[model samples]
Target: MSDRLFEHSSQGVSRGLSAGSPGSGRRLVVEADGGSRGNPGRAAYGAVVRDAESGDVLARAAERIGTATNNVAEYNGLIAGLRLARELDAAAHVEIRMDSKLVIEQMAGRWKVKHADMRRLAEQARALVPANPTWTWVPRERNKTADALLNAVLDGGPPVWEVGASASTPVAADPTGRPAEETAPAEASAPARGWGAEVGGATTLLLLRHGETERSQAKRFSGSGGEDVSLTERGRAQAAAAARSLADRLGVAAVVSSPLRRTRQTAEVVAATLGLPVEVEPGLAETAFGEWDGFTFAEVGQRWPAELQAWLADTSVAPPGGESFEQVLIRVRAARDRLIRTYGGKTVVVVTHVTPIKLLTCLALDVPARAAYRMELPPAALTEVAWFADGAASLRSFGVPAEVPEDGEPIHG
Candidate 1:
């Protein structure tokens, strides 16, 4: 529904989710709700940003999350609200209220993700904020907007809503109530950016990074010629966790990988999960590290501190025997262009290494070169970015999802 419908006096003030002071609330208040019909069945999430006191929506987000459980859907809703509020204003202190108790406790560090998928997703949510985006648990009654949005998502929408359904105290479901909301998949709230590809013509690349490698495991510098060491035991576990999670969420799609074992093995994990083939893309390989290929961080610092510092300080600088960040970016960019030209709008999984994923994220976010260096990816973690026909891109998620728990320490990652 066009949220603009809430902008007029013509429609006598319907009881908005706010009571006496939503608009005037001191902090930005985020109310998020999500639901799945069969736990892991069809689901959707909705979130609304209220000014706090006077209960006016500064922004609203709602969408179908495909088939996920209520908990996953709820986390998606919370993360969406957190991210929207951040994009709208970074410094704005937000008081996020959710109807999911699991999210509240997990986000509060009271729960450990016994489930691998949930653990990773939990991490993704943590990365959404600059730091402490203040999450709270509210009674179902208080989260009316998010609830309504979720219900709308559940019913498919043929849109249970119209442009102006008289924004009264939003039609909340009676937890036990049946909604009269329309039923069809709600059209996505016109993406922030456009991807003008033919219907189903846009090639969607699911940019994935390999799980931990021996280099990553040993905190050693790893690059293109590191002999393509395979994923360490934990790396294998991370990749498997990711594969199972992706299989549940995105079902399956094409799988492509760097021939390097770290990535090739990662691809195999996902391929096994999705019953897809692993297409090797040599162009997707990690950088050729030349001389310092498998050196430890301490070794690199002791021997090549000057060179390392210069490269870190400037992406244009190359390692003693490795390619410059810019060079990697160029090759990855070419590979990406080629993929898009080939696949268009279809969602395909691309399992590769860190530099390429972060570089692609930087491109999508339109940030500077130094910014790519600032990204922090996890072992067997996942991030998503989308590119459009007009050359615009958006970072759907960077690093990993909060499906897994973190150290409760706030991160700038």
Candidate 2:
């Protein structure tokens, strides 16, 4: 959703007519609004810029953020509005109008931004403004246009645009008792500079491992060929915690999960939190452990010593009828490629198994298969990889866990 927001902003900032270019001395009025169906569910925001003197719409922006809090969505709207205003007129005196007192206060520096996500967004917004801009808190009634635009996008309608008075349209209020307005911008509004010249955009992956099952706690080899078990109560709690953390931090574009019960459940939790849906991928499933399913490592060593040794020694070696690390790497790579193509320059959460996660991480880091063995992935732990538009990859973090309550028993394997 952040990617979509950035795309819209990029187009508006990079290509549109400059306010100083046409109407050189007009004061700009920016009205913005953000909303969430579940306070953090089905989030979207809207912003519209107008010539304060003529009351003519200059440019408008809005997008549906996957899942985010009311506050986060509000901040996003503010950022979009300010960015649009900056792109529209570099020298126009701008006045921001919103119904969100929280955003007004915080951006005004009267309230401290504590959340890492909000703070990051705030910084991005501040970077666009070279000088102090006026901030105003208006009643919900006066902010209907922006509010309507937000609702329209959320309702599967078109985004806001810069509309001229001659091409004006009717404004509708949100049925849920919120003020609403739609916009139609009359001109192209892109930034003065190229959008992705120095650092090309990135597709960020938030990789997560599935939670605990009985086999996980027992230190057994559970694979896709084995019985697909659901997450335990403790695992569910861990997933919930992780969902909360991610909903707050990740402006996730989509949630993709392995086609396994455990992974599906975990992904569901996350998707619910983000107000997004889950997409299952067979390539993300765990390796087929074959004859070793549900067997302990020691048992596997005793029963299939030669196979075990061979498997550990070579990435190409398979266990009995099981898959090889190299094969796992192949499928995982394919999945990564598909994801990058499908969601380029976006942030995605991938719920998968340990081997897939490790292999994917290793692939992102340009490491050999042996690196997967060195990495230890805990149940519900998260790892992040950023893939750039120029084909470069970077590992942002690994083995990161959400702030979960100390109630669940530790997973063993």
Candidate 3:
């Protein structure tokens, strides 16, 4: 059989000769694919819609769908692609392409969808397909864009794709996220100039630390491994104040937060003010403090003095049964890179905790891990970092406190 197979639907039968030909009404080409690390292990799907005439990417979507078979993930990609195309232009002609022969044949009505899950996903995909659609099967080599997106998500990166990104444009690699290597010193390269001085637009991350928790107020070691804590009343007020501050900033595309309750609560306030949904990013969670959680410095010193000293002195030393600063750096770096890739040239509010924020700031500055200790990030404070396309980062601001009004109203600014 040929490397490419095309199947035209009944509605496309009349227009098959010129389905995607020039001058057609908004012809779109959708390339989608899915992958599973263990066939039923971690899985993700990636899809991109491009303008057929210009070959420019119109929209991109990718998601990590927990554990699933490769076939399910492929169908999910098709569904996501169709949905994106429909959202772009309902009347446009959509040409759906995939590397999965099974998905292509099933979607083309050439094979039966025997599994219940497959049937449901297929139906959902079909429902979103435009009035007249074309199904095409292309070899894997032709579908690298979608594959890259899928792999990025499976590798502990965020499930986001840049809209209006070029089809041939490569996703930025994790330049500073490697666990084994030390981040390059910022001084090694030319200093970053003011905004718009970089080669391309920057991805601005507005990092907002979570509001005051009980443990935080007591100066305790509040980490992810310990009890999940909520924000205090003051914390809520601080979140609202921070939200008001962010409301004045223009062009914030989305609000993302750690899964922990304190950060989520803070993110909820900010997202509500911005009229955007809160996206949970697990990598932004605080470092796990294990047995030392909820303990003050004095207490930890009394209980496990040697361990505390070792942890304080080394980045790779983990607390008893908890994560090390090095581990936190790895995940936070992954999260930062994912955000940069997903929201290139856009602004995003990252609601997280102390360690992640400090680590991110340190990474952007290309400073050593120890620098995280020198920084002081108060609860609900906002820091800003701009990541350029060329792997350079600029630290715009650090630990700017929210201005809470005396009258209980949100202080805008």
Question: How would you encode candidate 1's per-residue C-alpha lDDT over 99-137 as one tens digit per residue?
Answer: 676887787676776775566557666766543345566
Tell me the tens digit of each residue's lDDT in model 2 across 296-324: 99999999998898778655566787877
| lDDT tens digits by residue: candidate 3, 246-320 | 888999999999999999999999999899999999989999999999899999999999999888876656789
Best by TM-score: 3
Candidate 2 has an lDDT of 0.74
Question: For model 2, what is the error of residue 72's alpha carbon versus the real structure, in angstroms, after optimal superposition?
Answer: 52
- The lDDT for every candidate, in the order shown, is 0.65, 0.74, 0.78
Model 3 deviation from native, Cα RMSD in Å: 13.9
Model 2: how far is 58 from its true place, Å?
44
Rank by lDDT, descending? 3, 2, 1
Off by over 4 Å in 3: 1-191, 405-413
